[model samples]
Target: MSNIPFTLHTQNSAAINVSLLYAASSKYEGEWSGTPHSHPYAEFFYVLRGEIDFQAEGEPYSLHEDDLIVINPDVNHTERPRGPGTVEYVSFGVEGLCMDPADSGMWSSCSLFHCRQSRSEVRFFLRLLLAEFENNLPNYEQLCCHAFESLLVFLKRAHPQELAVTAPKRTARECSAVKRYIDANFRQPISLDHLAEVSQLNKYYLAHAFREYIGLSPINYLNSRRVEEARVLLRDTSHSISEIAGIVGFSSQSYFAQVFQKAVGESPGEYRKRLRRGRQEKQE
Candidate 1:
């Protein structure tokens, strides 16, 4: 399967390397007050649960769960809970990337950028960042740098108009409905009929459009999504190999092992064991 290349716009210029200075998580309830302030470091935050009314540079944003906001260096912003329910979020203080936020057109109009449509991608990298930050495994700092770079791509994709003049954005949206459907229901037995029904297009037409938009057939994309979720479970949970296989929609443990090894270049059990070993070695 072809991979989507996500770049950070480092062409013909010195690349920016970001470092994670501090990372923490908080869960709060009820109405709260925020202290408006600015710093020399960039900060990334995600609303893990509940909602918040976030304000930055005099603009008010009502953000719900999964919403992301990147606060530029030395820009003032604050977040207050929107309702009574608890709001859990993870945040990181970053340095080295925001030396001059104005170099990127996104920070010109506003110091805080909102990423509304990239919750899944952002969370994926954010999870890895937190994991690496806490464990301090070998090459963890380098891994966090790459995670932050992926986040830059998500930010760029979320608001392509904010990119530099020389950089062009190529995005696919015509078959987004099919992709979203598969992501949400990959655990079920899915067929071309189900995909076409969900996309409101003919099966053959949907196949051509899906392949054009994402460079993968509908079934292939489905398998990829399942495999991605399986990796998360393997890294974070204590589930057995067979249980994880079933949880991620594979019919049997052996088939799941084959697909996962082909895609990830290692068996699921081996990968999980390696990750855990590396993590424990560094943490200890």
Candidate 2:
């Protein structure tokens, strides 16, 4: 029998600053043996095939094909193979991005997330990422990174249960309309009145329909979108917090800070610092 315990392939060839790692194994049928471990960087695992049993903080679960698992930084966890089939997965270790567990809006408390992608579009992307990992083509790292981002976006939209919201059914067009409005006006001082006007529905009906269709109230959705935009700007640019606050439509930096803290569990400045440190550590 081959003695290779586990294979971890690390890639640093991306034009961007993020690090990508791919790991796969088949010898997981024995007693659980992975040491309880954690990473300072966020880890996203996409299960390509087979089953793997996972335990996070004493809660146990099993994952199958097309399932995405997120183990945030510093979370204690362990995993082992579940059956005789091969267990293949790709793990992304991002450096410059800081993900707030709270911002996910699915879990009230911090915990590991196991998300299944039933949508064909999402499953297609997952398969494409897996193929790239297995083949290691030229420029595959960049392709994999883009596919990974798309996968996350898909998961965020489709996996409401994971985000602690009831799943709702609405055509993609309707959902897009709501999301587009929020994205376009989140930085401005927007209100339900403005949103209902934009969506062309009465205030009460719009509020109810939006909640039933999109899974969040208008105000809550706007806040989340603005915070997400601010996070990206804080990480990617040298803009000051006050400048970003204005650009994202918050009238005051203090208000922005308060909302950000409540949603992200950290102030904008602190979040930016954490992302910078994460990148620097990866470089070293």
Task: Provide the overall lDDT of each model, using Cα atoms, as 2-decimal numbers.
Answer: 0.69, 0.62
Backbone atom clashes (below 3 Å) for every candidate: 0, 4
Q: Which candidate is the best by lDDT?
A: 1
Q: Could you tell me which 10 consecutive residues in candidate 1 have the lowest summed lDDT? A: 165-174
Q: In candidate 2, which residue pairs get closer than 3 Å at backbone N, Cα or C atoms, i.e. clash?
A: 106-163, 106-164, 187-248, 187-249
Q: Please report, as a residue range, the 10-residue window in candidate 2 with the lowest summed lDDT.
A: 1-10
Off by over 4 Å in 1: 1-12, 99-117, 164-284
- Model 2 lDDT, residue 183, Cα: 66
For model 1, what is the C-alpha lDDT against the true structure? 0.69
Error of 2 at 267 (Å): 38
lDDT tens digits, residue span 1-284, model 2: 11111212212222233444553333333345567675554456666667788764345768777666666444456777785656766555543232323234321112344455354676677667667777788877667777766765665566434432111122222433555667666777888888777777787876766665446777778888889889999999999999999999887999999999999999999999999999999999
Among the numbered candidates, top TM-score falls to: 1
Q: Model 2, which residues run further than 4 Å from truth?
A: 1-18, 23-32, 83-88, 98-120, 133-136, 160-284
Residue 197: error of model 1 in Å? 67
Pairs clashing within candidate 1 = none
